[model samples]
Target: MQATRMISGRAIPWGAKNIDTDIIIPAKWLKTVSRDGLGRGAFESVRAVPGNIFDVPANQGAPILLAGDNFGCGSSREHAAWAMLDMGLQAVIAPSFSDIFSGNAFKNGVLAVTLDEVHIARLMAVAADGAIITIDLENQVVTSDRQDRFAFAIDPFRKMCLMQGLDEIALTLAADDAISVHEARQAEDAPWLVPAQG
Candidate 1:
């Protein structure tokens, strides 16, 4: 995972609600555990159409995605966030998001921003004209050209994880000293409680 403090780049507006994890990376692309090359399969079904948004050159390597309400719904697939990260997207803006997808994305250092519908529509309009946008996770704000700005909320723990690039394992390892101390105390209190042989 990479630290996600602030991401500034062109915005790709995808105004579609109920975009599930299946639509994000597709089930066919789930065989590989590696995150690499998963971007090629992102939004495959939608990009198959001529002149689709994701296929456009202006949106190539865009760091931010503006989507409709209820984005990242359906199955709790971690690959969905992995594909987005592989595609160089650092954040997703929507009116709302599925809880599971949001958690998965946050753990992977993808900023999932929930803004009001008014702000989302304005961002969509600006994105149509190919405007650059900035998402400041630390500041909890999204800004773009024409002075369009919106604020969002995020859990403190999740925000810290994104800022420090701490995944689940990294978080646990952070408490290694405390865990060791506890184990030592337990062994001292109960010598025979420890398993003798495997």
Candidate 2:
């Protein structure tokens, strides 16, 4: 996981509501466990149209995505975030998001920003021209060339983990000393439970 303090780049506008995981990676593409090669499947359905925003060259490698309300809704598929990351998206902005998708995204190092509908609309407008958008996760603020600025709230623990690039296992490992102490106590309480050394 990479630490995401601030990101600046053109935002790929995907202003559609209820974009479930299926639409993100498609069900057929889920066969592979590897996160690689999933970018080709990202928004496959929407890209059929030749003029789709994502198909446009300017949006390629864009780090931010400006989406509609209720983005990333429906089934919890971690693949959705994986595909987006493979496509080089670092963050997504929307009015709201599915709780499961948001959690998965955060764990995968994707910043899911939830703002009001009005702010999302403004962002969509800026993204129309593939304008560069800046997100400061630590500061909890987003800014764009249109002079748009908005503040968002995030759980402190989640923020810390993202900033420090710590996943669940990493977080637990961070308490190695405490875990060692507890295991020593357990060994004293039940010596038989521990396997005897040969």
Shift of residue 138 alpha carbon in model 2, Å: 1.3
Give the TM-score of each candidate: 0.85, 0.84
* Tens-digit lDDT track of model 2 for 1-198: 778788899988777888888888888988997878788898889888898888688887899988877778887889899999988888998888999999999998899998888888888888886677899888999989888889999999989989988768977899999999999999999878888898
Strongest candidate by lDDT: 1
- What are the clashing pairs of model 2? none
State the lDDT at 107 in candidate 2. Answer: 91
Tens-digit per-residue lDDT, 87-185, candidate 1: 888889999999999988888888899999888899999988988899988898889977987888989988887888767686799999999999999
Runs off by more than 4 Å, candidate 1:
173-198
Residue 41 in model 1: lDDT = 90
Candidate 2 positional error at 186, Å: 15
**Superposed Cα deviation of residue 55, candidate 1 (Å):** 1.1
